[model samples]
Target: MNILFVHGNYPAQFVHLAKALAADGHRVVFLTGRKDPEVWPLTGVEVRRFELHREVSSEIHPYLIPMEQAVLQGQAVLRVLDVLAQEGFQPRLTFAHGGNGLSLFIRHLFPETRLIAYMEWWFRDETSHWCFPSYEFDQRLRTTMRNSIILQELEQCDVAVTPTSWQQQQFPKHYKDKIKVIFDGVDTSFFCPTPVKGELILNGLKCVQPLHIGENSLLLTYATRGMETLRGFPEFMRMLPPLLEALPNLEVVIAGDDRCVYSQAPDRADGSWKQALLEELGNRLDLGRVHFTGSLMYGEYQQMLNRSDLHVYFTRSYVTSWGLFQAAACGASLMVNRDPATNYVLKGDQAYWVDLDDPQHLVDCATKVLKSAPERRKNIKQSYLKSEWALGNCIASWVELINAQLKV
Candidate 1:
């Protein structure tokens, strides 16, 4: 089958799926923004750059910025699709990330093409408007207008795939029947426990160690883009002081790029709310004990997970993080913030649940897992490995779903 994958970044969610489909001899081509020219070299996938006039702006209203960016990018995508059509390049199926407007135009251009959108999230109740508080006054009024536009695009798709049932449930009642849940697979082979592994010697402290019987060192890790308030960053920071006071041996690692995504420029002031959090933590920051390894490479990330005694994943909403799945695959016992969306992915004894609103609960839940008996920890880790959450199995299932849909 000839497949055209569309996203702002090539192969973002379709990383493994694109490779899998290419290996099976399907023709895979990607249309993405003008960054990272060599993203998928070995997948036998071809990339077409979509050039847009404007960069994503942070000064304008946050809501308007992404919308304007998407429309501009969509125009670029349409131009590329037009060239492809002129060259007689027609795909049997089209897969796109729904947030972008490219798919809507693609459906109009190629009415016969079967379209499937990977629905990451949709704004429903007031809870979905967490990004900006000021936007709340006009959020529902704006969201209703935006939802109409969004639904028009989504309704054109033949099918919709979501990473979790929680995300699928976010769609309107009419679209719920069309949504299918498939995980964004993790690389289990790379994430598993490695014996005799030396501690991650970061900033002079040997914090990470392999699981050795009777070893009581507690390693806790939290990773993401940065310390964004909506991502529970402020709460994590608020909880840190109390946690540090309670557990002396506990070593915490915060990983990710410190730079704010929506910041105007690189040299801008660093006195954001996130920076203030770091300042307040002050002497208790424990440079040697609490490491901040900013934005690690994939291999280093896996190693960090492998070395963790417990992984704490906190999010204000239902958006699932690939890092959490990777940590679970690495056999690190996970303590996740409780949400309806998270409950769909993590279940039974697979993870310890915590309330997102309660900072003390986050610390307590993580501490409980950290202080658990070695045998109990080992059992939870092993159970996580065997669960449906494994990356390899998840990838296989995604391939099967795509293949079945394309066959129709």
Candidate 2:
């Protein structure tokens, strides 16, 4: 079967699925706005880059900018689809992400093509970032308005896919039947635990290295695509000083970019959350022990997760991060929040949970994990192995779902 995949960030959640289809001798083509060839390079798939020409009008209201940008993206994708259709490249099915409005006008171009919309997250007035402590009323109002695009795209899709049941339940009851629960999957083989050889590598160099596993050194890791409050970045930073002071052997490695990819997070005069934490914590923090390794390559990230003594992950009731699953796959001990979003993946017995409202709780959890024996970390990993989110298992599920979708 011929398949067309559309995503602003192509091959993101669809990487395993796309490659699996290509391996099965199916012709797979991806239409994406992503320009980073390094990131989107798939050996068997044909990739086409689409450009957005319409810039946000200065005269337009601030609240309308998001909707306008999405509409422009939809327009750009529509143009690419038209070209593909003219070239006799009509796909039997098109998989798109509803979050970015990519599939908004796809049906108009090819009414017969079945479309499966990927519902990553739904932006609602209340459940979204509005629930965050620092969210503003104006931002909430704008977000509520911005949700129309997703609603429209969801309405148009033949079916929808969500990585988690928690995320699928976020949609309205009317749309629940169409939203299938599927995990993006974790590569357990690549992320397996490594014997601590008493060293850490960063960009091919070891600056903040640990010599011994438990006696002379400690390895704690936290990672996200971005450093933001939704993932508990600020709160994590607040918890760090106490942990650093309590455990002198501690070495914290934070992997993420400075920008907030999800929503606007609180920033300092210099506009960096990291710098703000540095200023607030001041001499209280052992800066020398902290290593901020901004976004890493996939191999590097897996290696870091494998070496981590404890992987700390905290998130709101919103979308759960892929990092959590990766850490679990790596057989690393987890320190996660007790929020319902995380409970779906990390059971209470599988991970150490702390009350997100209290920064002290986070510190306590970290200390507890650090003090625990190194052998105990395997429990969390064992629990994750039972999950169907393992790489091959997830790809098999996707293939089954796609086959069913293609059935006449």
Clashes of each: 0, 0
Which residue pairs does candidate 2 place in steric collision?
A: none
The TM-score obtained by model 2 is 0.92
lDDT of 1 by residue, 1-408 (tens): 788888887667878877777888988888887488584564588888788866876686654654666677677888899998998888888888887676767866778888888888787655555655455556666555556546756888888888877777777888887888887776767777654254564431122543221235567778877566556676776766666667777777777766543212222277355566777788776655566666666766776676677777777664767777777667666777776646666566778887888767777776677666345544434425445656777887777776787688
Number of the top TM-score candidate:
2
Stretch of 10 with least lDDT, candidate 1: 204-213
Cα lDDT of model 2 by residue, 1-49, tens digit: 7799999886788898888888889899988888884665787899998
Q: What is the C-alpha lDDT of each candidate?
A: 0.70, 0.79
Cα lDDT, model 2, residue 262: 69
Q: Clashing residue pairs, candidate 1?
A: none
* Maximum-lDDT candidate: 2
Q: What are the runs in model 1 whose C-alpha is more than 4 Å off? A: 54-68, 201-217, 259-273, 365-380, 383-387
lDDT of 1: 0.70
